[model samples]
Target: MTEYNTVLAPVLSAFWDQPNSWTLETYLKNGGYEGLKKAFAQKPEDLIQTIKDSGLRGRGGAGFPTGMKWGFLPPADGGPRYLVVNADESEPGTCKDIPLMMAAPQFLVEGVIITSYAIGSNHAFIYLRGEVVHVYRRLLRAVEEAYAAGYLGKNIQGTGFDLDVTVHAGAGAYICGEETALLDSLEGRRGQPRLKPPFPATAGLYARPTVVNNVESVASVPQIINRGADWFTSMGTERSSGNGLFSLSGHVTRPGQYEAPL
Candidate 1:
């Protein structure tokens, strides 16, 4: 039998087994928003650099560098930019994101706030899979809780940083998992991939610069901000740094989600 004893590193899943793990109160008690406070201390560009230094790749397939993806946006015009979280986990056998949303949604919420602030976005969206009504409801409630705590909305934490987050449910198209397709679906159009050249960074979501990141990718940002780049680099390989959630199922005695170094 292969041993995962020392290989497992459960940063995101660390508290899933605890009582009321989804509640804001529980999240606060366990050093939840400390990362945002740290983020607020740094310049937005520096925040992006930190992720680059951490070597944190996208957990939503493709392994794209998360920081580089953020840096790809053209300098801010006087127009609206957006940060969209792709919560539509519809690929066959792909199950990590849904469970993360259901069990510890605050993690994604905190990550969204920090990401929006870093990217100079006044608005953000979580595009969820339509069939998961329960996850959608949980995400909505989490957003409401965040707003009440002043972690979202106008003048957040008195820093004069305002952000509004919208939770949108898709029609459950598997293609919507693709970033461009997800943007189209979010805009009330049919979910289909668009031709490139004017990639999402150049033009997206109402024809403005936009960033679409996966649930796990955004959720991992809080830890990178809080723990420092070197800490994240200590895990996984030199190329693929940091840990990720691995969904194991079908023909396995211990089939479940495991968070460990990539």
Candidate 2:
């Protein structure tokens, strides 16, 4: 017989079981905006460098390094550079993102703010699948609460950093989960993946430099900023770092979302 050591890490799922866990009040009580505050104290480039150092990868299937993707955007060309979050979780047996939104939307919202600030983006969007109307509504309300708390609008937290978040529900196409396809759908066009070379980073939404991240990927940003890179790198393997949500479904005795080190 062999014995294995197992540990559960609940960074994102820590408060899912709590009352009104989706509400801003609950999130604030649990040290929510601390990361945004910490982010404001540093330069945008430094924030990017911190993420690069943290070894955080995309949670949207590709596992690409998140910091490197953000760094791919060409030095600000004076035009608008956008940050679009791919919240359309349409892959088979994928149940992590929707649950995260339903339970702890503030995690995603706060992360969006930090990421937008880090990339010098004033406008960001959350592209959700239309099938999840309930989740869409939850996200809209979350954004509303964030705005009322002065976290989403101009001059956020009196730091002279401004951001606007728009939650757009897609037409429920599975193909839209692809980054470029999600971008096209976001532009009011039919969903389809675009050819590479001119990737989203250089020529993305509205043909400008953009950073497209997954729901879980963006949601994880706040914690990395709050806890520091070394803390994130401490978990998971040498190639893959930090904690991730594992979706367990289909005939399992204990089928549920599990958050643990990768």
The candidate scoring highest on TM-score is: 1
- Candidate 2, 123-237: lDDT as tens digits: 9999998989999999999999999999989889899988999999999898999889999999999989999979988999999999999999999999999999999999999
TM for every model, in the order presented, reads: 0.98, 0.97
lDDT score, residue 141, model 1? Answer: 97
- Per-residue lDDT tens digits for candidate 1, residues 127-199, read 9998999999999999999999999999999999999999999998989989999999999999999999799
lDDT of every model, 2 decimals: 0.93, 0.94
CA displacement after TM-score superposition, residue 46 of candidate 2 (Å) = 0.7
lDDT of 2 at 36: 90
The superposed Cα distance between candidate 2 and the true structure at residue 58, in angstroms, equals: 0.5
In model 1, the Cα lDDT at residue 74 comes to 95
